[model samples]
Target chain A: EAGVTQFPSHSVIEKGQTVTLRCDPISGHDNLYWYRRVMGKEIKFLLHFVKESKQDESGMPNNRFLAERTGGTYSTLKVQPAELEDSGVYFCASSQAGVGNSPLHFGNGTRLTVT
Target chain B: AQSVTQLDSQVPVFEEAPVELRCNYSSSVSVYLFWYVQYPNQGLQLLLKYLSGSTLVESINGFEAEFNKSQTSFHLRKPSVHISDTAEYFCVLGADKLIFGTGTRLQVFP
Candidate 1:
């Protein structure tokens, strides 16, 4: 089976611009998650989606960032008015079951660079 | 809340030598532990996981991690590592969400 797929493997944009990253989970997977790793930092959670509803979004950094999982098949993360600090690798993962029940399959990630 | 700590940011060892990567976690309740590896130019992959039962878990490629409740640790070990073992390994704690350590880069020289 194909693993999770992330679009635009690399993106470069200026500060104050807007950027959107997309993720397509494995088929039949209901749990989708977003995680980001800043340079030299740990990968941190961004949000989670169970089907079309968001299960947890507490990790979202600020109002400028928005995530939507329409129909629950895929997810998109948008960072508006991007800041220089927003440069990082955005990874998407999916699991067949909830947190502990299943292992997450991650994508290669979208490397975003904001200047 | 929970957190994961990978004691080593990097480990260098010669091929066919033994190696250990330490991971310590902090949580109030029982936790599930996982080790994920990212090979060069590849996405993250599950190396092994420990949910219950045996405290020791082994991956197909000879990597093993032992979960120690007393020490609050899940350190990975391999008696004979190959050059192909080079990669970044992340120790993760599974709570309501997955909390990851900063990651340790394993560099195996021939």
Candidate 2:
């Protein structure tokens, strides 16, 4: 089976510009997650989706960041008025739903550089 | 609240040598421990996990991790590592949500 794939492996945008990162999860996976790492910090969870439904979004940093999963397929994370602090790697992961022990499969990630 | 700590930021070792990467976590509830390896420009790959029963977990790549509740650690070890084993290893804990450590970069020299 194909793994999770992401688009635009690297993106460069100005501080106030808008950018959208896409994540194509593995086929038949119901659980999708988004995480980000800034500078040299650890990867932090942003949100999760289960079949196009928002499971949890408590990790979202602010309202400027919006995420959506349409048709229970690919997911998109859009950042408006991107800040310099948003420059980092954004990783997308997915796994089988209702299975706590199931491991997550991640995409190569999109490296966003906001100047 | 939970957090992970990778004590070593980088570890350099000669090929075929044994190595250990220490990891510690703080959580009020029981957690599932995991070890993931990330090659340069690649996504994170699951190496092993300790979900319950048998405090020791082994990976197909000869990597193993022991979950110690007393120490609140899940340290990964490899008895004999090759150059191919070089990668950044992250120790993570998963509960209602997943939490990860900063990661430790392992470099194997020939």
Candidate 3:
């Protein structure tokens, strides 16, 4: 089976510009997660999706950030009016189950650079 | 609230040498511990995980971690590491969500 796949491995945008990162989870996976790492810091969870519905979104940084999973197949994270602080790696992961012990499969991640 | 700490930011070791990467976690509730490895230009991969039952977990590639409830640690170790073992390792605490440590970069020299 193919692992989680992310699009546009690297993206460069202006401070006020908008950017969208995409992720395609493994086949038949119901649980999807989004995480971000900024300035060499630890990866922090952003949100989670189970199928087409959001399971949790308490980690979202601000109102400018939005995530969506359509048709329960793929996910997209959009940053409106991106800021310099948004420059970092955005990782998407998926697991076969939503249980506590289910191992997650991650994508290579999209590196976003805001100037 | 849950948090993970990787004691070492980086660890340099020669090939064929033993190594240990320390990790400690703080959580008010029960947590599942995991070790994930990220290679150069690669996505994070699950090295091992401790959900319950056994306190010690081993990966297929000779990496092992012991979960100590008393110390709240899940330190990863390798008896003799290969050059390919060089990568960034993250200690993760999994409950409702996954909380990651800052990470430890393992640099193996030949």
Candidate with top lDDT is 1
Q: Give Cα-based local distance difference scores for all models.
A: 0.96, 0.94, 0.95
Ten residues in sequence with the least summed lDDT for candidate 2 chain B: B91-100
Best by TM-score: 1
Q: What are the TM-scores, per candidate, against the unseen true structure?
A: 0.99, 0.98, 0.98
lDDT of 2 by residue, A1-115 (tens): 8999999899999999999999999999999999998978899999999999999999999999999999999999999989999999999999996335588998999999999
User: Which parts of model 3 are misplaced by more than 4 Å?
Assistant: none
- Sorting all predicted structures by DockQ, with the top scorer first, yields 1, 3, 2
Interface RMSD, all candidates in order, equals 0.5, 1.6, 1.0
Clashing pairs in 3: none
TM-score, second chain, candidate 1: 0.98
What CAPRI-style quality would you assign to candidate 1?
A: high
The digit string of per-residue lDDT tens for model 2 on B8-72 reads: 99999999999999999999998898998999879999899998999999999999999999999
Better of 2 and 3 by TM-score: 3
**Local lDDT at A78 for model 3:** 99
lDDT of 1 by residue, A1-115 (tens): 9999999899999999999999999999999999999999999999999998999999899999999999889899999989999999999999999888988999999999999
- What is candidate 2's local distance difference test score? 0.94
Clash counts for all predictions: 0, 0, 0
